[model samples]
Target: MWKTMILLVLVNVINGQCSCSKFTDESSCFAYGYCLFVNGVCVEQKCEAIPYQEKCKSPLCLWKDNKCLTFKAAESTCQTLLPQQCTEYQGCYYDYTNLKCQISNNCSKLEIDQCNGQLGNGNSCIVDPFNNKCQEMTDCKSLSTEFMCLSQFPFCLYQNSSCKPSSCNEINDSVSCSIMDQCQWNNNKCEIKNCQSIKFGYQCNGKTCGFDKDQCFSCIEQYGYQFFAGLISLLFIL
Candidate 1:
């Protein structure tokens, strides 16, 4: 009776251990759509049950033997792919709307006026210049620059029947300006310019520069050196 009970317990433990599907390599795990790695074991990865936001946009589908294959998010490695390719190749990408691989021709060309209608009410979309697909707009608060906002939200700076990039002058607070790396706010605008682009001018950011900008930065950097040097000289004198 004792031997039989021990045998049953061993069998139960083995069954519990073998319940999860195993893979020797990560590649095999991914190929089988099992991406979770736990305790040196590959386990099934559960995709979040998020609803699809829009119809699949296409023309960026992967080509094999001259045929465009629909993107399969689960089967394809999307995060590993370059973001630049997502724009350059048009639809040869896994559609973020549905999290699936899509063909380039699957997406229809959308205009600025039609973009908002593609997404849910109150949600907006941008018509990408490369593919003309109506991409859903990201929240305005999460964005830093007007150019990026315009790319994500086509209607960001609308005027004269056209959309334009937002300017740093639109920022209302010092914190927002600092977050944008515009250390100095002047004339109600983020006016610091790129120092390297102009002679003797200090670069405030990538595009703007200020004459006083370089002097201020130079003083700050030298302040530490000057302090250390003065301390050393005082020690020698003493």
Candidate 2:
């Protein structure tokens, strides 16, 4: 009986090691809790093998009790968190007046960093010039300054002393559009540059595009899952 139990344990360990080897790509391999892509091959992973706390945040590993461990879903409510922990928890903020962690929907209550960090469905939270409150920026016309307009590159443009939605074909000056990150001079006319043609990190902007690790990346592809996950968590609490 003891021999049979030992054989079963050995078989399970062997199967675990070999199972990850079947995955050929990084994305597919990393999707599984027990697998990791290493040296161009997919292999079995242990939470202890990961060194950094930030890197330990995937579905497979959790950083808790000052150690990396296999992830186990836990119900950590905002009301249960202490003042310091409340600030660390996503979508929850410490209310000093109320002296508790609370789910916040009012953008006006957020500070500059917190406001800017709130990204939802391609809309970014910005301080409204009229009310001096943080809110999702939806229209180009709301931007009153050239600096503000230009900051939303490829989406808004400063033209005729007003901020307006940009159109590559509407821009007549090849010299002016050429300097812009998303526009270029093409066939003697101003045209939007292809995102693939952007070689440097500084050149990528707009709602859908981003730069990471010296490579141009789609913002939707990169951050969509994380955004949705946070949204779902917020909804559950609400």
Query: In model 2, which range of ten residues has the least summed lDDT?
Result: 9-18
Best by TM-score: 2
Clashes (N, CA, C under 3 Å) per candidate: 25, 0
Q: What's the distance in Å from true for residue 152, model 1?
A: 5.1
Model 2 C-alpha RMSD vs. true structure (Å) is 16.6
For residue 133, model 1's alpha carbon misses the true position, in angstroms, by: 7.5
lDDT of 2 by residue, 1-238 (tens): 6555555444333222225555566765564345568999877768887655655653356576677776432335456556665544344555566676555445566764445422223345565554556665557887766766777766678889998977777777876776554566667888866655678755655433444345554433423466546554654554
Over 127-228, each residue of candidate 1 has an lDDT whose tens digit, in order, gives 555544555543454334444355543224544444453445655655556554333455565544233344432232221221231331211232246654
C-alpha lDDT of residue 135 in model 2: 67
How accurate locally is residue 231 in candidate 2, as Cα lDDT from 0 to 100? 51
Residue 98 CA displacement from its true place in model 1, Å: 4.8
